[model samples]
Target: METQDSHVNSDETKDPGAATYGNFINYYTFNPPENRLGLIPEALLENLGLDSGDEPVLMLDVGCNSGDLSVALYKHLLGKNASGSKLHLLGFDLDQDLILRAEASNPFPRNIQFIPLDITDDAESQICLSSYLEKHKRSRFHLCTCFAVTMWVHLNHGDTGFKSLLARLASLSDYLLLEAQPWKCYRSAARRLRKLGRSDFDHFKALEIRGDMAAHAGQHLEKHCSMELMQSFGNTSWDRSLLLFRRR
Candidate 1:
């Protein structure tokens, strides 16, 4: 419900780009205004096959750092469909501290729940997400948004790891909104990995020159998972793209 600026002191936090590694709160506080992020809920709602009056829409936010964007999106959806559509939002992150902060700060606790989850881990993701879906009587997630998480998986697990992560994400959700970072930003990710003393840092470089990184990744997703890109939004400042995909 509250804007990210209202929740944290942006002036006090250092620029996210300058930090070698930082927590979710640091990133949320200092990151530039991402107006495109707010467009996700509307996009999902428009494409959701269910009628507005039929059933509650289920949405998932993967790697939902500090829950700022998730909460804002929840409010936006509620505002658009006041009487007809009910939304149940679930936000997952690997950071327990961030989840705790999200719970503490959430204004609409009844409408949303934040859980510490590693969606890339097979057993953990299956057990946790399956249980939740079972409880809700849902077959698949109506919409899933993953922002700036691919690079982390790639840097840690390499190309194979990233694709596996994408496959899992695609399997869980009917529609996916992904933010893909360009190859130029690979150096920064490598630096972050190095700061953490990672021995596998060279993996990122190997994956860098695939050519028009976002398109290359999208092609891979299309071929492997049958996901087709619906629309794309460019963020020139960051050399990143926000892509919306539908499972084919």
Candidate 2:
């Protein structure tokens, strides 16, 4: 669970979390790095057989708010790396403030990097991500993790936008670790907006893709994105499933 001090500090500035509102500025305060780390299997990345052939193994953390989880995951993988392959992790968030904080607090400056990016902007995201890949002489990241980030895309961008996110990540990654927010979470998010006296998310009610959100994403990845489910790391404390997929 999140540290009491962190949670208290976050609550001091917490937003209503509406779609129109920016993301929870200090998200890891409520959903701590340890809680997120507990659900992941040991040596998960190493087990994926990621052999970069002398180059450092590259990983991407999507929606990497505040970089706590990204930092934790990098250390976890680095410590247990039996093959002694150098590891480089890149974490990005749409929130420039969050990314700035991530960069400021980052411990492993050489191995981990944080940048601000809005993944839904196809051209911008593609160009930025492609540039990173090109710099490292890598076609795609060895692993990509998108935890508890789908709802915002779905609620704000509609069904089509949701699918597009999954498809794009799959294209950029050899393996994907996704934690899509469930349907009830969507209702709760919508309700929170209502409670805050904010207008409803425009794309919420019209979304054709509803119910079992993780499954819907999985199906789309396999059927439309040429990816296959590899395994499940089980559910997080928030009752969100952590699923792993690989490009076919």
Candidate 3:
């Protein structure tokens, strides 16, 4: 796969121009961990069948920022002693600053290994992933969670980037808990912002995973982002999930 090695600083401050509605996600428009906008760690563990003590399993938080989700995963797994499994959690991010902050915070289990990496940058992400896996080759992750991340890429790299990311992720985990912003929501936000003359960003386009990466994996894909699905998940639910192609 072709990879972009150019060290693109993803720091929101580095490029004010990039922070357009195209780059600025409503979810991350405010304090992140404090807001808990992405309750991904919990939902992912639930899907992974993590019950106390099942032998320390390998867990990866793809876009871990300040280790909030990493900490949540650790706390949740620790709460469960189902099989007495030890957890070897790995958190990766494109921002070195966040990785440093996560390391300094030390919020998760002592076993967690936080690394500076970016998924869009294939060489680094793959190397970091491979090295971490080899170091703890005993177990593979039972589940992986990627939430509110694809849209950011779609904004940056277009549909092709989103599809590539999904394919790459599918190759890495048995099951995935993906939480993406429905296109309607993005569109609504865009129109509102435009009407207010708040921003000069492109109109949000409708995108769905079912016909995209989900089809590629050939797994039963279900969308629960609609009103009914949202209700089931809850009004306070800040995220929605799609059980992506299952690894049979």
TM-score of each: 0.82, 0.90, 0.63
Runs in model 2 lying further than 4 Å from the true structure: 1-22, 80-85
- Badly placed stretches (over 4 Å) of model 3 are 1-55, 80-85, 138-140, 188-236, 242-245
Best candidate (score: lDDT): 2
Model 3 weakest 10-residue run by lDDT: 223-232
Cα lDDT, all candidates: 0.69, 0.80, 0.51
lDDT tens digits, residues 202-235, model 1? 4756764345767866887799988999877555
Cα lDDT of model 3 by residue, 1-248, tens digit: 11122232254333222333223222233434423433333444455465456555676777775676567556664565422346667777666666776798774446777887768777877776777667766434556656556555654555566666776666566666565555544454455445545553332354444233323222322222110111122212443344333444
Clashing pairs in 1: none
Give candidate 3's TM-score.
0.63
Cα-lDDT of candidate 1: 0.69
